[model samples]
Target chain A: MPEIILIDDPADPRVAAYRDVRERDLVGREGLFVAEGEVVLNVLARSTLCEPASLMIARKRVAGLADLIARLPEDVPVYSASQEAMDAVVGFHIHRGILALGRRRAPASAADMLAGLGEGALVLALSGIANHDNMGGLFRNAAAFGVDAVLLDTDCCDPLYRKAIRVSVGAVLVTPFATAQGDLLEVLTAAGFETVALSPGGATRLVDLKRPSKAAVLLGAEGPGLAASVLARATTVAIPMATGFDSLNVATTGGIVLHHLAFAALRD
Target chain B: MPEIILIDDPADPRVAAYRDVRERDLVGREGLFVAEGEVVLNVLARSTLCEPASLMIARKRVAGLADLIARLPEDVPVYSASQEAMDAVVGFHIHRGILALGRRRAPASAADMLAGLGEGALVLALSGIANHDNMGGLFRNAAAFGVDAVLLDTDCCDPLYRKAIRVSVGAVLVTPFATAQGDLLEVLTAAGFETVALSPGGATRLVDLKRPSKAAVLLGAEGPGLAASVLARATTVAIPMATGFDSLNVATTGGIVLHHLAFAALRD
Candidate 1:
């Protein structure tokens, strides 16, 4: 069982890393990330892609989470503090009372991840998705649709951002993803992926597009959609929508396209 | 052309409806709703279902939006204020510089809204969806997929709430919706509709389900998905997700289901 340490003061050096979470998130956490709430904490405990560094819980929550705490590795420390102290340490009022510090494993290179996929793998590639909520939503949808991996262009926001992780309901913890080192499209092409870029003005309707054995679906931010150069190389597909309406939210677009690809793959 | 009136005081009576927007949204706005940003204001301008009650814009924005303001009905009042004064009036920093108070045409009864649908109509029914962002997202997806009308059970939040309208990117203004007065499912059934409820343990996979002539897809809040009683009465359909994963976000689920129904209808 992991050791339960009682912490009475917010300034305890042992819990120093948990200080001012919101501000720290705006800066960087070195190589670590904070996971909040019971749901995400549970995901961190069970996640193979990331490891929980430590846990801090409200003293009142200790009894309720005893079973979960007992399951933690012996090396992991569990700190119990008064809700007031917990709030002070975190620099915010987090009612959920459960927070975990997590460290992600070294990520594989984008090329390596793509090359390692099975012949029938489906991948989601994101470009310039600046909104953390959109980033999280894309990962949540990608995981739901069983995409083998996610590749992010350099301009995309970090999936492990506190808000993104929370918004994704812990999907960013479990989903395998890598940041692209070079041109994302070129890398995909070299790895044998039949790339499809989703845009409003596309040549093929999503309903009529044929699925490839190995495919990557690309999505960009809401306003400036996929780059023209990227669209030039990939099969451009559109999800038919009411005329004159702007494109669906990028994450919603991801869900629709991923579902179509996943369902098509399942049916055949 | 609409007249532009400048106000230097934050407490001006003419703009009282725009005061403390975040708090006002909670207290209810009588018969009015606030739409923010240029995008939604533009939608409100063109919307046939909702009329612009007034416009409050930052003084700096007046020049750039002159053409748009000129297109508005001369009867609608346009109020302009300095950015500082506008921020004071709204109780927050609304950098968007555009705000429109809109009055919805008295909504149609759920029965009448459903009864008026085309023979080949697709409707989205929502229950217990209390989150404003999800509510907005569902409406946005409904609009994107050409859903004829949205039926919201009593438990659902108002899609016209300021935040919901913002997250929906103005889709809420253009979509037709009704609040269900009686048992939602019973009303749906009475409208010559075949209802489908989405859940993790659904009886049919979304891929294999045959489309009906006029269908209503029901989605519930994330934790307590469609009431078991409703699920029992409707054809329960599941979007096949990865094993052991929880259900997708309610709005994401709406996008997938609506896309499927809309696309299937288009093909046949």
Candidate 2:
């Protein structure tokens, strides 16, 4: 079990990493990201791709989180602070009462990650998804649909962004993901993935598409969807929508498409 | 065209309805809701169910929005303020530069709203969904899927809440919605709608369910899902997910279910 260290001073140097969290989130967190709330901390505890550097918990919550703390490694420090001091340190009132600083393990190349998937694996490929909320939602859906891995184009925002991690409910901690700096479709094709790029004006309806043994659903930002070049190279598909409205929130679209692909795999 | 009334003072009584916009959003808009950004204002302009009471715009954005202003009723006030005055009045940094106070039309009872639907209709029924973002997302999906109406139980939050409206891309303004005070199933059944309640423990997989000519897809909050009483009264269905991972964002679940029902209707 990790040792419980009481912190009365918000400015204590030992807890320096936990200061000005929201500001640091906007600026980069260097190699670390803050995971908030108990549910997310639980995911971080079991995550293999990342390690918890330390934990900062409201003193009142430590008693309730005994089992959760017991699960973490012994060397990791668990800092307990009064609600006032905790609020002072984080520069905000965090009612969730649990926060963990997590560090990513060594990065994996997109090609290497895709090569590791099984023959019939499902994947999600994201391009130009700059919105943190959408990025997080995609990861959450990808985990639920059992996607083997997620590949992102260079233009996509970091899934490890604080809001994305919080929005994803910590799915970013468990789901395997890698950035593909080169042409996403070419790399995907090389890994035996039949890419289905989602678009509003695609020729084929999503329900009518034939399921591939190894598939990747490629999604882009909502308004300017998949790039024309990428769409031409992949199998372009559209989700049937109401006559007057053609757009669905990009993340919602991801959920729908992943559901179709995941269930198709189940039936087969 | 609605006349542009320029106001340099943040305290002008003519634009009193737009004051402390954030606080007013939380403490109820009396009978009005605030719509932000150009995209949502355009939706409000076209909506028949809700009419704009007044508009507050940054002085810089007026020239570009002439076409949009032309669409509003002649009597509706268009108040333009300098960026500083607008920010001071709204109690926030107004980056989107457009805001409108919209008043709901004569309220319709849930039964009456459902009664207005044609023989072949698709509906969404929500219960215990209090999150504004989820509420907005569900409405956005409902609009995208051409849902005839949305039925919310007493436990659901107001869809017209400012955050909900913004998150929905102004879909809440255009989508028809009514709140049910009593049992939701009986109301749906009375309206000649077959209710399909989605839950993690549902007996039937969503993909296998036969499409109903008139259907209402029922959803609950993410954690508890549909209540047992409601679940037993309706045709319960579950989305297939990876083993040990049954949760999907409530709005995402709505999207998948609605997509399935909408596409099935198209195929028929």
Candidate 3:
């Protein structure tokens, strides 16, 4: 069981990492991120890829989370404070009453992550998805559909951003992902994966796509869709849409395409 | 052509409807709602169901929106203001540089809206969807899949909320919708529509669902899925998901189910 430390003061030196969470935005730079709420904290505790550095909880919530606390390694510190003190530390009312600080394992190259997957793999590759909300939603969908791994270009936003993690409901913690610079399509193609790009103007309709033994679906940000060069290099697929309507949200689009690909692979 | 009226004062009575928009939440109660941005303004101007009460544009954007202005009816007042005045009127930076006040027509009953759809209709029925962002995303997906109409239970949030309208990219203006305080499934059933409820425990998988000549998919809010009574009354459908994962977002769920239904109907 982990050690339980009682904290009465918000200014306690040990809780400095939890101060002004919204203003800090401390996720990617130092391999550290925060998992908020009971559900997310549970997932973080059980996640194999992420390790909890420490935990903080409201005094009232400790009894409810005893089983979870007992599961943590002895080296991990667990701190409990009054609701008022916890709020003062976080600079906000955290009604969820539980939070865990996590550290990501060493980074993996996109190629190394993909090479470990078994045959008949389905992956989601994204470029220019700078919006944190969309990034979170995409990770959530990726987990739901069982994508083998997610590949992100350097231009994409960090999936571990606090809002992104919250929006994903902790999916970001479990889904294996890698980010790198350069041509994402060329890398996938060299890995013997069928590359498909989603665009408004494309040669093939999304529903008509046949399942491939190895596949990667490329998605771009909304407004300015997939770069023209990316579309030119990959097999372009379009969702049949009503005339005069704008494209669907990027995350929603990813969900639809990924759902189709997932089920199609099952049939094959 | 709309008559252009220049106003230097932010407190002018003509633009009172667009004041303190965030605090006022004025949409359906007084038959007035505000539309922002160039694209949404254009959609509101052309909508046959929603009529514009007046339009306010930044003085700099007036020349750029000349063609859109020409399309507006002469009776609709077109007010132009300096950027500073426009920001002061809306209580924030009106970066989009455009705003239009719209008045909703007499609401059609759920039955009336369903009755007006053509044969082989596809409809979306939402219950207890109180979040404005989800409501907006649902409409955007509905338009992308060419849904015939949308029916909302009385518990659902107003789709015309300013945030929802903006998030939907103005799909709310073009899609026919109605809200009533009763069993939405019964209304759809009475209108000769097949009803399907999406739930994790659904008896049939979504991919296996056959297209019906007239169908409506029932979706409830995220956490407490569809009410038991509603699920019992309609055909329950599930998306095949990986083990140990939670359900997809309600709006993303709608996109996948609707995409399948739309294509299946075409094949039929």
Candidate 4:
């Protein structure tokens, strides 16, 4: 069983990872990635591939969760803070009383991500989506729709940011993503992938495309949309949209596209 | 033409309407709302109903835009803050460079919302969605689909909250919405509206709805979903789906439904 120690002090160094998250934003390289709430924390604890380093809970709610709490290594820090201290340490009032902190693992390289695709995997290639919540929602949509991976072409926000993780409702950690694509189309195409760009003004509707051996979707930033150069490379596939909706958020658009492709491909 | 004045001090009361927005969550009673970026600000200034109460611009970037800067009223507060003081006032980073404080107007009531419902009005009824971003996006999607109004059920988050306003890209101000619903079914039935409860396990597909004269979608909170009593009171609509997908965010799901309804209602 993981050791669950009582913590009365907000300043306790033993719970250091759980404190000072906002202050860490000023540090060049020390921002904390926190997952809070029972639903999210439980998901993090179960993601053995990227285990949380420590767990903290409200003192009163720890009784019946003994079995779930035992899954972590005993040496892994587990602190039971009063709800007040839990709120104080987290920078804002997070109602999700339980929080788990994890050291971010190095993200997979874009090249390595392309190499990992199975025969007909679908990947989301984002361009200029700066909002963390939108990125998280995209990942949540991707995971729910069964995309193999998500790749960020330069200028997307960090997927591991606290707000992104929260907006994703814990989907970010479960959905595999990689950043840094040098000439994104070149990279995916070199990896034997055909690129499909989702746009309202495109030449073809989404249903027209049969499954490809491997597919990558190029999505642009929210307003000005995909760069002309970026769209030039991908096959233009528009979602059969309702009139006047010349836009969809990068993530939701990615979701609809992924859903259609997943169904067309007959993938689980 | 609007007047522009530069103020070096953070203490200047002229910019007060736009100050401390992230921290001051309640500005609704004051009848002022903030819109960031040139795009949303421009849109607000152009709209007859919305008016900019103040304008803030970066010192260096103020040179080229004589026309946009000139469009404001002379007495309207236009305080050009140094980038440093600008950051201090807004309570977060100001990457957008320009910000506008606009006058808020009373929303059209649910009855008034129905009175304006032409053949193509798509409305969103908030059940328990309390997240600010979700609330904003729901409103934004409503506007994108030309939704007539969003009716806030009791207990939904305020659309005017800074986070919701910011996240919706200021679509909250553009969309017509009001808060209050005695009974979800009763309101829709009285207004000649079809109330569709959007749930993952719902049996009716959106495409099968046959495009009613006027329709309103009932959406729920993120985690717990629609309360059973509320769902029990709805028409129970579903989006077309593939097998493994769980559900889209309440707003996105609403967006998909609105899009299809609009597509069917209007040929363009």
How much is B249 displaced in model 4, in angstroms?
Answer: 3.0
TM-score of chain A of each: 0.97, 0.97, 0.96, 0.91
Best by DockQ: 2
- Chain A TM-score, prediction 4: 0.91
Looking only at chain B, model 4 earns a TM-score of 0.88
Candidate 3: where are CA atoms >4 Å away? A26-29, A265-268, B26-29, B265-268
Pairs with backbone N, CA or C atoms under 3 Å apart (clashes), candidate 1? none
DockQ of each: 0.76, 0.87, 0.83, 0.22
Q: Write the per-residue lDDT of candidate 4 for residues B71-149, one digit (tens) a residue.
A: 7667776777788888777777788678777776555677786677766567788887778868877776777667767
Local lDDT at A181 for model 1: 72
Residue-by-residue lDDT tens digits, candidate 2, B119-181: 778889999999999999999999999988899999999999999998888889988899999
Candidate 4 per-residue lDDT over residues A1-268, each given as its tens digit? 8777898888888877766666654453254477767766766776634667787888887885687788877777788889888777766665657777875566678888789887868888887888887887887777666777788876888877877877776777776787765777888888888888877677877656676778887888777787778777678987654343344666666766675676564423
TM-score per candidate, in order?
Answer: 0.97, 0.97, 0.96, 0.82
Fraction of reference contacts reproduced per prediction? 0.74, 0.93, 0.89, 0.17
lDDT score, candidate 1, position A82 = 95
Give RMSD to native, each candidate: 1.5, 1.7, 2.0, 4.3
Q: What is the lDDT for A173 in model 3?
A: 92
Error of 2 at B8 (Å): 0.9
Instruction: Give TM-scores of the second chain, every candidate.
Output: 0.97, 0.97, 0.96, 0.88
Model 2 regions lying over 4 Å from their true place: A265-268, B265-268
A best-first ranking of the candidates according to their TM-score comes to 1, 2, 3, 4
